[model samples]
Target: MHPQYKADKPIDCPICSMKLVKFEPTPNGENKPMDSMPGMDGSSSSTSSQASNNTIYVDPQRQQLIGVQFAKAITKPLSKELRVVGKVSFDETKITHIHTKVTGYLENVFVDYVGKPVKKGDPLFTIYSPDLVATEQEYLLALRSNKELSKSSFEEVSFGSSSLLEATRKRLKLWDISDKEIEELEIEGKAKRELTFYSPVDGIVTERAAFGHGKFVNPEMDLYSIVDLSTVWIIGEVYEYEMSFVKLGQTVEIEMPYSDKKSLYIGKITYIYPVMDAKTRTAKIRIECKNPQYTFKPEMFVSMKIKINLGTHLVVPEDAVMDTGEEQYVFVD
Candidate 1:
């Protein structure tokens, strides 16, 4: 019979003359399971009397069986997923260039510096144009004629001066002059020598091509580059080899360098440049964003995450999944 080992003392196995492994006793007076410690072997003890009689050696099989059982009950399951990198860019459609409809000197500058925000119909600059002055004169003459004919018969108002009034108003409107300006001119009965040019859109003045006071500007030279900062693009440059994972309308997360925060932007592969850049060895992809608060600026560096969906596939934690570079592995427990 095997000798029973006491919980508080190190007992020696009489048969092998070796020290037996000690363990804490459970509430039922049995030893608590220790995976590292050896257990009772069936060959050494077939009955309870034999187990406590003389001495019996611990068995390796029992330790392994307990270990297997513990692992099976507590281990977690994990799956593998794919990860990729990308970049941020601007939406080309949202971009526009601010230019002049008439050729003249940049007499005055209202939007004085670059990066100045201007709203639609907000006067950007005032230019003294001889042609604009001539148009104003014609409009004034037509207004005066219509007023004079209004005292007469409806026939004169409709036929005698209608065609002339319509013709003059069309010329002023063609030059983007608002009807309000025309009404103000008619009431004041004065010709405005300088024409005010308003911003065509809501945007920031990106480039001030407008030369200083008295600088000559023509249609050939751009006056100012107004950019709407509300929306921007995230450019994802995919290599020819990595093209499969990047499809149109894939959702990606962008990481900004300045903050720990990240933004989720869904990208529809709007434009894929047909030709590859010979120098970069990459294809150009255009991403559009609606940056209302102007958080994103031009040329701001951004990290992109392109997740490839395997469709109903399993996914694992990035830390738990061990990447051997060539392969991936995960621990069961």
Candidate 2:
């Protein structure tokens, strides 16, 4: 090409001085950089016009077009919350099994149904026992003998009828026959055919095996399984790897599956099971919680979160983060 042709079209490779050809591999319709080259003046005509039109004047002394990127150096704190799922349970220690001390037929069950709440000394059932009747008769005879012997001519009662009467009264007491029952027997001068059994603990009856309206019960058979609802047990199922964060005393936030509302409860790691579930790879941790309102029910599912402070470390917004697996990165503006 002659100098006149080059000056008019200016479509020649600067290095090799060849005719310019466009490349179509890019989104830009034309790629004319194949032949374009900077002149001896160290300037480009196309970019110069854009710089003058969109330049930002930072100070009166200088002006420059604002670029779309910036960078910041920061240190982020790594605070993590570990989430686990667990179930609510009754505190094993607070559970009581009301059993019969003496075998007898359950003539009447006043509180036979399950889920009945009872307090200490509350009548639970009535038992008709031949043995109790005979004992009561002996107590009555001892009482009458004491009154008769006191009037004896002998200054000192040889057998000590007063002592015998006291011992007899104690026998009934040992059988958990309430003082009221014993007093009634004392006043009425008759044996109570049916003894009313009272609850030994304040709790709800979770299990009961009253043999119908009229059934026999043995000392070995559990008459009723009572559980105190005032306090409950929370079993936290934590991953084996995350078990280190769980200690003897840790504050936990419990959220019920039914609703998003959370309950804050302080728990002590009273028990950590020695073994982990082979398939689930989770360890069982028992926590004691007070259910003052009895709102927490047994077998209820709950989500637990254990907060862990990893100390102050670096962090970045999720949107600004780019994870390459081997390295984490953030785009500098």
Candidate 3:
């Protein structure tokens, strides 16, 4: 292993201290280390023309001949960005389901078409329920009886009539009858033929089951589905190994697949599904976002980015050891 002479025949490798072996010249023909043990030394440190603890210490001349480059490993902050495909969906909490409290035929529908925007207390439809009419007549009769018993000397008669009136009013309310309608009925002294149900919230009707002048509906039927689009949910899937980086309240950036390319939606992680998909081996994460003007559509595809910051860690350049598979390192010179 002397620098003054070259080994033309079989000789022992000084560095490996093994049996006889012949050295093949490097690409540059500069004398390389007799033997190199990958991952034995840190990326950078002082070196001499000696191998210690299986660390290959190359001299400056040999280092130049082999075009050796050294980089000092340093501690620095790093971050990883996860790019994934996401799907836009309605926030379940913001979705409102319309159902009738009583069975009846739809006499008239104000919100006749899907995608119609409606506010709280807006008329949805009118129903002609014979039972509702009978209930209304009972309420009127109770009202009259209570008024008659108002001056009765017997407190028991007065209390009995007042209780009947209250019970009738409560039944009407339970049937989705508004207080305004009850007041109007009291003044008119007659039950209206049609009972109208109002929109329970400010939202856009996404689905409708009632139509025409005679659509029979009951409590079990889903008359309409209205969704408040001000807030939406974006569900994204990440690899099983990457699930550790996902956490609640982490900010995420969203880009629509078919909309304006320049526009980006900001959102935050609201939930992380505990189960992983068996087929794709990915975990689902839900992000909540504000959708102004109904910018997000249900079932639409989107791209999402989530950046995870990793604390300061000792790192080096990207390089691989030839024989060593996982463990990689560099020589010190």
Indicate which candidate wins on TM-score: 3
lDDT of 1 at 166: 87
The TM-score values for the models, in the order shown, are 0.64, 0.69, 0.83
Can you tell me which runs of candidate 3 are displaced by over 4 Å? 1-33, 36-50, 59-62, 320-323
Best by lDDT: 3
Order of quality (TM-score): 3, 2, 1
Q: Is candidate 2 or candidate 3 better by TM-score?
A: 3
lDDT of 3 by residue, 131-229 (tens): 999999999999999999978999999999999999999999998787888999999999899988989999999999989898888999999999999
Which segments of candidate 1 are over 4 A away from where they belong? 1-87, 150-160, 258-270, 278-281, 312-333
Per-residue lDDT of candidate 2, residues 87-137 (tens digit): 899988888887777778888888868898899988888988888899999
Query: With candidate 2 superimposed using the best TM-score fit, by how many Å does residue 108's alpha carbon deviate from the native?
Result: 1.5
Residue 24 local lDDT, model 3: 46
Which pairs in model 2 have colliding backbones? 69-333, 70-333, 76-313, 76-314, 76-315, 77-313
lDDT of each: 0.66, 0.74, 0.83
- Quote the positional error of residue 300 for candidate 3 in Å: 1.0
Residue 120 error for model 2, in Å?
A: 3.0
The positional error of residue 11 in candidate 2, measured at the CA in angstroms, is 26
